[model samples]
Target: MDELEFMRGRVYGADHDDAAPRPGRVYAELVGGPLDGLLLDVTDRTERELRGGVVLPTEIGRHGPGGGAVYAPRGPGDRRFDWRGDVP
Candidate 1:
């Protein structure tokens, strides 16, 4: 599996016995832009929150510190979030 798929439901630095998604956790694969291929844990997010999208901090984005990358759900059932752009 690709990096994105492998990281599903898995947090960075966490240990697991298998590739299966962890129980009670949800993840969204980021696509495009600086944060591409990263996974965002969204287990605690409400449907309304998911629909509204999120901004994640990134050190490598165009604006550097104090900047964030925006990502939004691709659709109703999709697990991938598309990069909208960056914000300072």
Candidate 2:
């Protein structure tokens, strides 16, 4: 199967220098952009893990600098990502 198939349309975008990726959340780097692309499942991701925030995988791996940030709750009053079905 192709890589896209593995993503199952859960692919997300992220600049390798995007400061930081929220913990519990996933990010996808762009093919040509400075990012390396990330993937996440908001619906299934645990809320507790997000509380501490997260650095992008690349950053966590030391491939780059800081990335993850304080993971804000996606509650009704908090900032939440709007899924457009485009994945990222």
Model 1 ranges off by over 4 Å: 1-23
Model 2, which residues run further than 4 Å from truth?
1-10, 13-40, 59-88
Models 1 onward score TM values of 0.73, 0.27
lDDT for each residue of candidate 2 in 16-58, tens digit (9 for 90 to 100): 3453456665443232122223343344545665444333333
| Residue-level error in angstroms, candidate 1, position 42 | 0.6
lDDT of 1 by residue, 1-88 (tens): 9755654555422445643557778878888887776667778887788997888887677899889888899987577999999999
Clashing residue pairs found in predicted model 1? none
Q: How many steric overlaps are in each model, in order? A: 0, 17
TM-score of 1: 0.73
Whole-model Cα lDDT of every candidate shown, in order? 0.75, 0.37
Best by TM-score: 1
